[model samples]
Target chain A: MKNVKKVLAIALASVMAFATVACGNEGTPAVGTESGKTAAAGTWRIGGIGPTTGGAAVYGQAVQNGAQIAVDEINAAGGINGVMIEYTFEDDENIAEKGVNAYNSLKDWGMQMLLGTVTTTPCIAVSAEAAADNMFLLTPSGSSTDILEGKTNAFQVCFTDPNQGQGSAQYIGENNMASKVAVIYDSSNAYSQGIYEKFAQEAKNYSFEIVSAEAFTADSNTDFSVQLQKAKDAGAELLFLPIYCEQSALILTQANAMGYKPTIFSCDGMDGILTLDNFDVALAEGVILLTPFVADATDDATVSFVTKYQAAYGEIPNQFAADAYDGVYIIKAAIEAANATPDMSVSDLCDALKEAMVNITVDGLTGTGMTWEATGEVSKDPKAMVIKDGVYVGY
Target chain B: MKLRNKFKFDKRARQSLITYAMVIIAFVVVQILLATGSMTSLMKGLLVPLCVYAILAVSLNLTVGILGELSLGHAGFMCIGAFTGAFFSKCVQDVITIGWLRISIAIILGSAMAGLFGFLIGMPVLRLKGDYLAIVTLGFGEIIKTVVNVVYIGRDENGFHFSIKSNMDLNMTENGKTIVKGAQGITGTPKDATFTIGIILLLVTLFIVLNLINSRDGRAIMAIRDNRIAAESVGINITKYKLMAFSISAALAGSAGVLYAHNLNTLTASTNNFGYNMSINILVFVVLGGIGNIRGSIIGAVILTLLPELLRSFNLDNLRMLIYAIILIVVMLFNSAPSFIQFREKVTAVVKSKLPKKGGVN
Candidate 1:
């Protein structure tokens, strides 16, 4: 009898607490804007979503910082079409449900457009909801095909995962970087698997043979001596790492220890390896990677963005930061091209932006005259850069 | 008929009714708030998931609290249920156009499949006791997640094809669709899960778990939990009772997974989805709610799940987790400290004496 009362007592108390929290807010309508032209805030609300704190925080934090820099510049230049652009970012923690919740939170804050969700899996989930709501979404660094597969309303600033994979294969084949290549990838991650699968398939078109394909799980990400040794034993001239730099750093150090110095090649995930804490820079001396942005590029646009980003964030911006910087400018172009107004409905603006995205090409930090396809893929050429004296340089 | 006639408004009956009424009243209040658009959007989005964690916590309690065994792999069972349930929904969604009917069938199938795995695993695993069982369950749990990542299935005009190698080996026709795409997971699963359905499932889980805990078998199970060898010496079938508790607990966890899968569009098998961390989280709910307390688990799951998301609203991204950690320690002290419980009991007793008695239901 005592136990029964205890159960009922706790249950009742908890329910009351929940009820109070649920009724804490008196919300307006859940949707962004009504069908008819509604009186709107003079500022364009652009909401960003990404993992601000987690294993993938590097990417999300870069995107957020980069977008903030661009937004500040745009608003300083008298905003987009003379209306100030209001920017807000929500942290998704790289979880799909949390990402959707962040999207809803942004909607509650009266977001007119979305600029992110830097990771892939969460982007896929959020993109689906954005597609249903007919919201205009432009992800900065979400490179998976699934994120934009059927969602025409969604666009990417970075090249798709397949583009990097196919481009790497073609680049290597064109320059004859290596005849025998050994690939190491993280199979647990969708982005790595997506790139690896395409690269392997595309490699058949080139003269190089993928000698050995080694895989690792998220749990087994650390300790790549076995993988490095296998690649060395295969007499591979080049080693392809379709993984993030966190693991790639350990792999390079281990390979250095074992005296197996093959030509190291990677995708964009290795762009900011030099900035990693406690990592020896000499290990990455001759590493080559296919990326859209090189922080040390002498080009005026790249140098300006890089300089401003470093002044603000106190670090060299990676490819993710560059993509997000390009994302904001591209949104500016889309709005100007469509002549979209703050008073227009969300669906109306989405339709206008969808058409404008493909027609208007914007030259920005990541690419020049970058145009988007109706398929939601960005058409951008990737530059092959090599690590020289600890800084990335043109190959 | 005689038993039905003999059913009276006893103390136990009244207690159970209070629990039911509490759930009902809360549901009604939320529905009103939702209709009026008064609930915060973050809370609104978290509605189904709150129910999911609550259900998962309660189900896990059946094993850790009632069965007196530590199972760190309960999330593995959840992963199995989620993937299978989502897969079934994707396969038959077109044929079974009705939402409620298909969801009903999916829940049953998902629960049954989880129970089947639990029973089969329990056969070999039940022989071991204590930490050995925990280690083995944890091992198998990871194995399940790892296996699902590699498994790929597709559907075409000809039929269904399965592959462990890769999605390419499925060799589906041009018109065929790849249902499972390795690590990318099943996309475009119909969003059939609703808050109403989640609440109904929670109620169903509470009924089964609470009634099971009160039955004759429940006594035997508890007796075994208290003194396994003594209960066995007194003619209790230890293996039978233990396996029964475990498999049923797993089935309920599976039902919770059904809700989890349908709630999200992209269903991928990540470590955070169903891994060591998730199992530890459910265990924390069971332990914090007070071992073997069903109502406490529900409340604990709700509060803990909402605490982090609620804190996010304040824009304290850096300090959000730090605050959550402090609150967790404080709650642990309140729930477990010997002096605190004594103080709380005295305070509650005084409060209870001043409350008026309600009319008994006849």
Candidate 2:
């Protein structure tokens, strides 16, 4: 009896301590806002979320860096409507649950706008809650069409999977690169699978024959020999690879080992493949892909943004960074056009921002004439890029 | 003597009552906090996941702790339940409008399917012991994930069609909805999972597992675990008891899957959700919590689930997993190390002496 009572007392005390700590943390943000210690009276709080530690860390880190650069530039220019932008970043680890958790945490911190959720799954997961809470979410790289379904305030800066896939197919046919093409994809990945399905459907309309289509799981040790051999046997002249950087590197290595060289084409997922450590850059030579941003563009806006990003991060920015960099400017334009004030509630501000975003257009570093439609779809023409002399150059 | 015996409480009953009281107390406290808006939305969002993990931990504890088996495919069972339950709900969502009813049916179907798979897998796999069993279960998990990635199911005016190639091969009408789109998975699952429902399902899992542990069959199974030869000589069927415990554990994990599936808008057979990592995570919860200790499993699940989220808020995202690992190691050391046990006893003695004695001591 004594022992039981002692244990119960300890448990109760621990529970109380935890409750106190949680309450203390929750109250800190509100208290700080009230005290005006860090943020001014008219400061706009913006939060960014992305997978900064997982497999997609490169994309997430690029997005965070890009958004920070934009925020720094905007604040340096005397801010938006004379209200300084205070930015906070959260890492979601590419998990849907973690993404939602990050979203809620930022909401608790009194964030009014969200520039985030670099990957597809996290973006889709967070958008539902964003809709429910009436928060304005502008994802820089999430390109799933399913994410925009029934979501009013959620928007993406990247092209949808179908758009990129169809565009790639059209580009291939118009260039007369090959009449017979093959596809190698990771069936376990939603992004890869979605792109493959759309590309296969569009290839038929372009009079391109899909001689072979093969898939492999998402395991690290997956060898592409069997699939690559099958494609080679089928006389495929062009190989469509819709996978991420790491897998693309592995596939390139395996294909080189098999002594099979074909014109490699991919989507935006292959943007940073050439920069991965220990990757064979020679294998990536002449590989073509469709991307919304090109680091070697001659346009003034693109060149300046790339220069700034290289100066900040000591490396040229990928498409993810460019999209995120543009995402911040888009948000800034919408906020200015909506005449939103910091005093308005988050939901009201979100409504005004949504209306403004649909009607506004921003010429960003990724492309000119970038616009958001009423259905929360983004419109931007991507550039054809190819790896040349160990770097991506506009084709 | 008779009066004393009448007043004496059964030790097992007391422990069971304590576990139930602890769970209910924790649930009520969280509910009150959520109702009063004292908890942040991040914490609120963790409630359903917390329950789901608790269920997984407890069910895994049954296999790894009580049955003395080293199964590493708990998440595989969860995957089966998630995909099947989500598929059933999507098919009948238009017909069944009541959220609770639809979820209940889905849970039943999911658990049944998982149990069937558990039986089929256990028949051949359970014959192998120790490392072999662990390896086979791990393979089973990977196999389930791979198979689900290729499976496509759709419903049209003609009937339900299943294919391994693509949704177009299902030959569905224009009005037909694709239930499972291969790797894309079932999307737009009705978000009917609430904290209250999660809590209720968790309670059901606790009741079933705890009652099974206390039942006669439980004793028989534990006897087999303790000494299979002696148990066999005593007329105990080793295979029957092992299968029973394994199937029950799988079913409970499936129920957890039902809660998980309905909570999310999209259910994918991805590495993060229902993969090798998740299986190992549940095993960690059991081992770190003191194997076979039910109350410890609950505490372990809650703390570990909240630890990462708490760490994220502190701008320690890079070290989130490291900190979680360190905390687990520290807790496990405290639970098992002889020096810590002695220190704990001393502290308890000092605490007891400081407080006044109540009633007669044991």
Candidate 3:
């Protein structure tokens, strides 16, 4: 008994020491936020919150790396409004409570401006907390209109849910993509559910007849055979998936095994499919999606941003990255318009940015001449991209 | 009996006091930290959740330890409480403008709703023992989460509208506002859960549970746990005691849920927060704290909840979860393994003998 006790104690002690040393091993961050010290003057402290550790990590990581690239470029170009930007992204683990904790921690570190919360639920949770403080927030990929409802302090870098749905239906209708459509979406996620509601409403005006609409929750995300087989049996020519890449990758594989193949259409949520670990890139072939950015675009801004991102992270950046990259520049433009300094209080800066956000137009890698309304929704035309040779090409 | 009367503490009363004092001291220390400006805002935010988890652990220990029944659906009771309470607050937030009064009624309503479900589920569930009971409770937890996910409730000037099909099915006037959006859940709940209130609730849980355990009903319940046949032979109402313990445990868990729903800025149904994952986490707290040991469960919950956050503050950002898993394994082994328990008992005996005895010692 004594021997067992000693052995367990020794093992736990060693493991604790190892955990301390392992913090700096990951290339993510050497240290986390300081508790008491606020951001110093002359540096605009911007904090981001997202799920860097959970099921939706792909979106969070893309946004984290993408926002970093933008900050680096702006600092190299002599800073935003003559002040350097300091960016810190906290992992929310894709849970609402943790997202609020992340927001409060960022506030503790004297964050002046916010750019985050990659997913919808956490974004909604954090936006409510941020609204209470009247902090200026620009979510890069949180496309739920609920995040902006009754709160003028928050804005979306990506199009709102209705916009994506309306845009996709219009594209499919004008191009005569398909006559019969089947939709499979995550009903629990605000991002997926919001888009699905609008898409179902908008599909009424299109040429397609809705054959099947199946819903899945996050807990039941693993098996898509049920949802897929139902859609296949409906004889739908096109499957519209308004969900994330994490589940879409599995859905495509499951559908493939069931010998079901149909034209696939998705929203910006399916942007990082090729980069998902252990996913066969070939399975995602011919999957067309409506998004604001395509990495392979020949535009000089897209090429430069894509090249820099690949050189830095050794992988092609996705639409989430593009949105985050544009988010920072949009923040810079709004800051320039307001002539706000880092020395200002968070509430003052938020108030100034709120007015300036409506008046600024940004030409970014995501979109050229992007503008936002006082409703906190961005106005930008989403482009259609098809996966060919495992890369997104203009449809 | 004369010595016990003179000392003003039997073993049971002393044990209960220790649990109360443990909570009180911790609350005082936290208050001091807050007043001193030493505590971080993140830690302050977690204080209410700590109370919630501690309450959950203590209540679950009652069903698992005292009743000797394995219940994996305690979180299901919690979810019922959370949604019911949240629904009431949403419907009447306008009518009941007073925060404390509204929240008090919400807690009572939430507790009653959860207790009703516990009684209903325990009727059939308590008939099964061991693994069968465990499986059914697990199913109950999943069923609650899934049911809440599909349920949509909205209210307008006309009345209340509810639908299981879709939110669109609830065709209300343009002025109508949704209280619960099917999967997304209720948001903007009044964040009224404070640390002081949490501590008070924890005390109430301890008071009720400790008192229940020392009562004649608790003795009957434990007898039923020890030997069901023997307990039945002694004329103890087996089903009555069993249902009593189970329902009370479920109701305490419901109070925790009431605190939880009000603590968050948004209330949503998800696996991580309200499903089997959370039920298992509470079970871990109970088991690691030595099952029936009420004080130990609270200590375990507080430590496990704060461990990751404390590690995060120490700059072990990503490694905290990994280290937390390892610590849980080690603690569970130390707690439950026979050899480790034997070793701990031996060491404590030696230490006790080394100390000088007081007059109360025979």
Candidate 4:
């Protein structure tokens, strides 16, 4: 027992030592040191929250990459109003409780504004405290309206779920793509359910026949054979998939194996489907979806942003990255429009930034003429694109 | 001799009292910190979650630790309670504007509903043992999440309607409101969960669990755990005791769920809430805390829940999980290894020898 106690004590002491060393590393790079240029005035401290280490880590990495790129570019171009942007990124692990903790930690660090909380759930979780504290939170890819509803200080860069869903339906109807449609969505996901519901509602207006609609939760096994078979039996010419990329890839794989070929219509959730490994690009051929940003757009701004993003990250920026990249620009524009000064208190700046966000129109990589609605939702036109030869092309 | 006997402590009762005292002390310390503004907002935000996790770990310990059964569907009960509590609170939001009172009633109703589910699932599941039981319970958790996702409840001019297909099938009036939006989940739930209430509920859980541990039934359950056939020969109805312990465990977990649901404005049936990962997380707390030790469970839950957040402040974002894993393994080793126990005893003996002994007080 004595030996055991000594060992236990040693272990405890070592763990504490490791913790101290880890904490010591955090202080090495203090806030406001992102750029080599010294701030003549006070720096604008911004906090970015996302899941950098969990199931949604990829999206979080993309968001961080985009936001960091924007910050670097701004700082290189003589900083925002001659004050460098000091950004801190916190990993929330895609959990609400952790997200709240990250929010508090950043707030304690004297952050004037928040740039992210990449996913929908964390965005919703963090927005509550953000509203109470009067902190401005601009989420790049949290498309759920639930995050923005009744929250004055929270703003989203991505088009809301309803917009994507309704836009998809309009595109299908106007283009005369399909007379009969079937829907398969993850009922457990807020983003999926939100888009699916709006699509169902809008389908009535389009005079399309709803053949079959099947629901599955996130906990369901990967085999979507039953749902796919049902849609096939219903003779669906178009299948609406309002789920994320991974799930869409699996569903498409299952449908392909079953020889169920249907023109797939999806929302922004399926944006990164083509990037999945072992995903037969042929299965996704002719798949159409509405996205706020497309990499292949011929516009100069789009080409420039895409080229820069590829050079920086060695990959094409998906809609999530594009939205996050735009989020930083929007924040800069809002701060400039509000005439925010270094003398203003954090709370005062946050209030001014919130008011400014409501009035300013941002023309960023995602879309031009982007404006915020009274509901804190962003209004922007999305492009209709179809996957061809493993690349997204405007339909 | 009588005076000496009076001073003699009943070991079990003393242990129980110690557990309660530890909880009180921790709560007081946190309260003081909050009052002094020394605790970061991140730590303050964790206070309620810490309570909820402690409650879950302790109740889960009742089954996995004392009962010696591997029940993996504890999160299913939590899911039931969360949705039930959120739904009840949503319905009575305007009627009972008092946050505390509404949450109080919601807690009772939610636990009762969870208890009912526990009883219903336990009736047949308790017959199985070991790994088979674990698989079934896991399946049950998955089923609960899926069912909640597909089940849509809405209120209209006519009345409340339930539908499995879609919310559109609910066929409600124009003034209708969806209380449960299938996968969209229960949103706009009353945020009434304060650290004070969470700690209070945790105390209540401790009181019930510790008392149960000392009761005759607890001994009988433990007896079954030790030797089921021998216990059956001794005329202990194995099934009855198992179900009782399991149902109680579920009810307590349900209470934790209610606390969790009220803490958040939006509650969804996602992996973070009512999925397999959450169940496993609670199990980890129980195991890492020294199975069957209630106080250990609380400590484990509090430490593990805060570890990630604490690590985040260190900017070790990528290595946080690796560090957490290392600490968890070391703690577990110290908790159960024979060599570690021997080392601990030696240190304690030396420390006791260095200290002066009490004399006349006894």
TM-score for all predictions?
0.93, 0.94, 0.90, 0.91
Q: What is the CAPRI rating of model 3's predicted complex?
A: acceptable
lDDT (Cα, tens digit) per residue for candidate 1, span B1-362: 76664564255566666767767777898899788766766777888998999999999999988999889889888988888899999999889998878778889988999888889888899888899999999987888778888888999999999987666678889888889877667887878888999999999998998888878898899999999989999999999999999999989888888889888889988788888778888988888777887877887888788777766666676788799999899878876688877877877776566554522322
State how far residue A79 of model 1 sits from its true place (Å): 1.1
Candidate 2 local lDDT, A247-281, one digit each (tens): 88888999999989989999999988877889879
CA deviation > 4 Å runs, candidate 1: A1-39, B1-9, B169-176, B345-362
Evaluated with DockQ, which candidate comes out highest?
2
lDDT of 4 by residue, A1-395 (tens): 44544455457546754563344344322322321123225678788999888788889988888888888889989777877888889888887767888887786566778987898887887888788778888999888888888888888898888888888888888888889999998877778878888888888898688799998875674889999999999999999998888989999889888988999988887887877778887889889888877778888878877888899888887887888889889999999999897556556877898788879999998889999976788888888888988888988
**Per-model C-alpha RMSD:** 3.8, 3.0, 4.9, 4.1
- Which candidate number maximizes TM-score? 2
* Tens digit per residue, CA lDDT, model 4, B1-362: 87665555377788889889988987897677567555556667778999999999999999998899999999999999999999999998999999999999999999999999999999999999999999999999889987888889999878899998777889998899999988778878878999999989999999999988888999899999999999999999999999999999999999999999998877888877788989999999998877898987987787788787788776687898899989888877777788876776777787666555543344
What are the per-residue Cα lDDT tens digits for candidate 1 across A1-395? 35534765567566746544643442234342331223365778899999988898999999999999999999999999888888889989898988998887787666889998899889989999899889999999988888898788999999888888999899888889899999999876777888888898899999999998888877788889888889999999999997899999999999999999999999999988999998999999999998888888899988888899989989999989999988999999999999998888789999999999999998888888788889889997888899999888889
Candidate 3 is scored at a TM of: 0.90
**Where is the poorest 10-residue window by lDDT in model 1 chain A?**
A30-39
How displaced is residue A230 in candidate 2, in Å? 1.1
List runs of model 4 lying over 4 Å from the truth: A2-41, B1-9, B229-235, B338-362
Task: State the TM-score of the second chain for every model.
Answer: 0.91, 0.92, 0.93, 0.92
Which tens-of-lDDT digit does each residue in A1-395 have in candidate 3? 44554455446545643443342232112112331133334688899988888777878998999999999999999998777888888889999888887887676556788998898888988898889889999999988888998898999999999888888888888899899899998878888888887888888887788799998887788998888888999899999999988899999999999989999999988888888899999999999999888888898898999999999999999988988999999999999999987767789999999999999999988888889899899998898999999988989
- Residue B31 displacement (Å), model 2: 2.4
Can you write out model 3's per-residue Cα lDDT over B1-362, one digit (the tens) per residue? Answer: 89966575477898899889989988997798677655555667788999999999999999999999999999989998888888888888888888877778888899899999999999998999999999999998899888999998888889999998676678888888888887888877877778988999899999999999888888899999899999999999998999999999999899899889988867888888899999999999898767898987887787777677656656566786899899889877876788879878787666556554743464
Q: Which ten residues in a row are the worst by lDDT in model 3 chain A?
A: A23-32
Off by over 4 Å in 2: A1-40, A220-222, B1-9, B345-362
Sliding window of 10 residues with minimal summed lDDT for model 1 chain B: B353-362
